[model samples]
Target: MDENSIAGAAREFGGKVQGAAGTVAGNDETRAEGKRDEVGGATETRVGQASDTVRDVAGEAGDLADRAIDTGRDVLPEAGAAPRRGGDTLTQYAKEFPLAFAAMAGALGYLLAVAIRRRR
Candidate 1:
């Protein structure tokens, strides 16, 4: 797919041919060199393949992140309003029943303290 992959494949094929030629001519040194080229070519091809895979995964992650941002933009306003309305309701309740709200808040704080102490 990539230049390295193509070049490595070509190199490997050349090595195979060279190795065969050496065998026919009975040159051990030439055969050894050809075998070395073959291994180097195969390593280069694997490096190219790994590079391609990393590029693809990075592209996919970028696309996924873009989609997530778009979705968040579409949903945020409605999500934001819920908490505002809940806060308004709590304010109304506290105004109408100060003592009850205080008692409830104290009880919640006590429970949180107990939970923290148990963790420690």
Candidate 2:
């Protein structure tokens, strides 16, 4: 446990002891003080737990990010090569069938325009 957690537990234990002593001695003020200490200790313990949880989550996020970066590095070259090959094939086809490609391109643009107009 962290310092805060340990301190909180100690405070809580002391409060309980004080409260019991006050009860035996018939001292209302000591009893109230003991109760207050118990609450403070509980708050401290919660704060410590929250801090530990945050640290754990942050470490996990960092690990996930590192893994993502490594995966992207490993896959990028092969993934990138496919797009270049596809572009080259399209270029060759366009060169061999210029008129047909132009017609198809114009039709595609017109269809896209119509689709956009309908959406609006």
Tens digits of lDDT, candidate 2, 33-88: 88889888988888888888888999999999999988987978577678899999
Report backbone clashes per prediction: 0, 0
Name the runs in model 1 displaced over 4 angstroms: 78-120
TM-score of each: 0.62, 0.62
The whole-model lDDT of each prediction reads: 0.88, 0.88
RMSD of each: 4.9, 5.3
Error in Å for residue 65 of model 2: 0.7
Q: How far is candidate 2 from the true structure (C-alpha RMSD, Å)?
A: 5.3
Candidate 2 local Cα displacement, residue 24, angstroms: 1.7
- Cα error, residue 101 of model 2, in Å, equals 30
lDDT of 2 at 58: 96
